[model samples]
Target: MAASVTRVFVSHLAGLPVFDPGGDQVGRVRDLVAMLRVGRRPPRLLGMVVEVLSRRRIFLPMTRVTGIESGQIVTTGVLNVRRFEQRPTERLVLGELLDRRVQLVDSEEGATVLDVSIRRLPARRDWEIDKVFVRRGRGGALRRKGETLTVEWSAVTGFSLEEDSQSAESLVATFERLRPVDVANALHHLSPKRRAEVAAALDDDRLADVLEELPEDDQVEILGKLKEERAADVLEAMDPDDAADLLSELPEEDKERLLALMRPDEAADVRRLLSYEERTAGGLMTTEPIVLRPDATIADALARVRQQDLSPALAAQVYVCRPPEETPTGRYLGTIHFQRLLRDPPFTLVGSMVDSDLPPLAPDTPLRAVTSYLAAYNMVAAPVVDESGSLLGAVTVDDVLDHLLPDDWRETDFEESEHG
Candidate 1:
């Protein structure tokens, strides 16, 4: 049976003093030994080193210990120190962490770690007190291995974070159900001014991506706190259509102020989208779609997609639209999945790969129609155009998914992060 845990103190056995209830001189506390058994449980009896008369030393089991103090471990009754003998099990202490890769638990999750925690056991007055371990990921905050909220030692009632596959499977499940809007809601809890500051710190494109995730109302609230120039910089980074929607949501004076602060080219593009009805294709499209030439090589098409730096946005499906040589604008070609690009020969001409059978939507196409077209065609993005099939822009899947996810999704993400 494991010994009861109570307050205990430790000191050098040879230097410390101990005495019996009758005031008879007793042996001093010395070294401590903990068992190192692989696969089998460690010994329940914690041992201590003792030094006595005639220059003799002995190992005493903690189970035999009766009294403890800041400086001494008084035996159940004082006796000759030689009565206890050292065991072979005491020969090896657990090695340095780097010497062996040990399996341990972390946050109730299985974590491969560099070291484990150890401290004196209050009840075990033997050599080295042994009971609870601050296991490097070995023992600490014990969440359900992968819970969104990680509670500390004080909050933990009890736990058994297994260091195995069960722990990893739980983490994977939590990740799959995680959503972006949950992230936005948690970010919303911070003051709008703080949010704007964070937005400003992000690159133009990243800021735009975050803005897209935010609700229109929240987007305006955050932008309202930023300086007009900074707000304009973020707007310029967003898709022209998205910027127009956000601009429309703002007070007219704020919109005009931000537009005035924007770069001339960016302002013009946003203005063009803003002129369209909010419900139309032109109003919901992205102006940054990959517009490739018919004569371009597969490598050139891939390079064009790379320039956008759109990670985690399903960039594999790049829109193959107009060529630069075409008069006012070339005919809008079909979109290609990134996987197809990789599978085909690098020398292949992009024109041969164009799938003209793609469904087309005009600038005035309704939102419902665009969404249906995306679903029916299984396209990552559907190019929106005019009567002449001129490329207006493309509607990507991420924008659609973001629109569908709830605002509170960000909260889940915030709660999941350990560092946060």
Candidate 2:
């Protein structure tokens, strides 16, 4: 039998020489650009996208592998490395999934990569992979020991591609594992019907996450490609703020159609957020804050983190408080950065960490004022409270910066500044 693919797979590339299929060294193998699994189990290596330079990347099919030695990934190509251009990291969802750590769900089958796909524009050519998700696949391990055969995808010789080129299968094989933005970009490469089918195949939470990351124009375009119900389902799964923002940007007819398609509760949540201007803290935060009583132990707070696994932005910090009391009027309290909690004494009352006795502001707090407040406080984040002073959500420093300095404009003044 031929050598096992696992033995040949290059997981480490400390001194791996990267050559232009021409044998001239262009650069050393900097990193595993992206790993795409072709089939269902043993997560067969369909294609490997590699970084050619700090700014450039190239795709190589696993089939081209001549060999894997002590510190190198040998390739069979003879093409110029300069031919490939660099894709923006924001658009590289495959890169994200390949890097993200995930639970492998130990079994006889090979591990999988889970990722979020995204799109850049309505008429863009391809989708992108934004975040890395490894240990992504899940399947069964044989219950009985004797009859079990743990076969990997590479070990099976019959798996063939349409073309001998490994690059051809890389995109399709990595379908489920691509980033949300990348998914949107890839759909642009497919027929509308096929795009809809892929959209349907995606899980709701994953779809929701991706939808939030996509550009508004791409979000609408992808939504247009989706079947009405599937489109609504994905929207419903998205964070209320993001869904609201997308809905607010959509045309009246499509907005109505999507909202009608969603469940009443979800629709209402989206509607509330839609009513707010996208630049506000309310527009930036998920209303679902993981709140705990001030008296709750660190263990109790951590249990909530495991249970809900809040979104990254929200989970940046967990808010501590008292259970709703008799008055239920002024539960105004402070927030705790997750890192702070980890470093503090385990038994310490979270109430002690409430840094800002300042009441949470209305979501309508002016952008200029928000920036000033955050800067003055040197805070990474601040809770957005309602009239009751109860924590509604948080406003991250980045979110404030996005409002103060949107992507559409350039910072001309900073180009010549020495004032700071």
Candidate 1's displacement at residue 114, Å, is 26
CA-lDDT, candidates in order: 0.55, 0.52
Instruction: For each candidate, give its TM-score against the true structure.
Output: 0.51, 0.57
- TM-score of model 1 vs. true structure: 0.51
Task: Predict model 1's lDDT versus the native.
Answer: 0.55
After TM-score superposition, the amount by which residue 18's alpha carbon in candidate 2 deviates from its true location, in angstroms, is: 7.4
Considering summed lDDT, which 10 consecutive residues are worst modelled in model 1? 92-101
> In candidate 1, what are the lDDT values of residues 233-300, reduced to their tens digit?
88888767779888998778878888999998788878878877766677777766766777778998
Q: Candidate 2, TM-score vs. the true structure?
A: 0.57
lDDT, model 2, position 362: 75
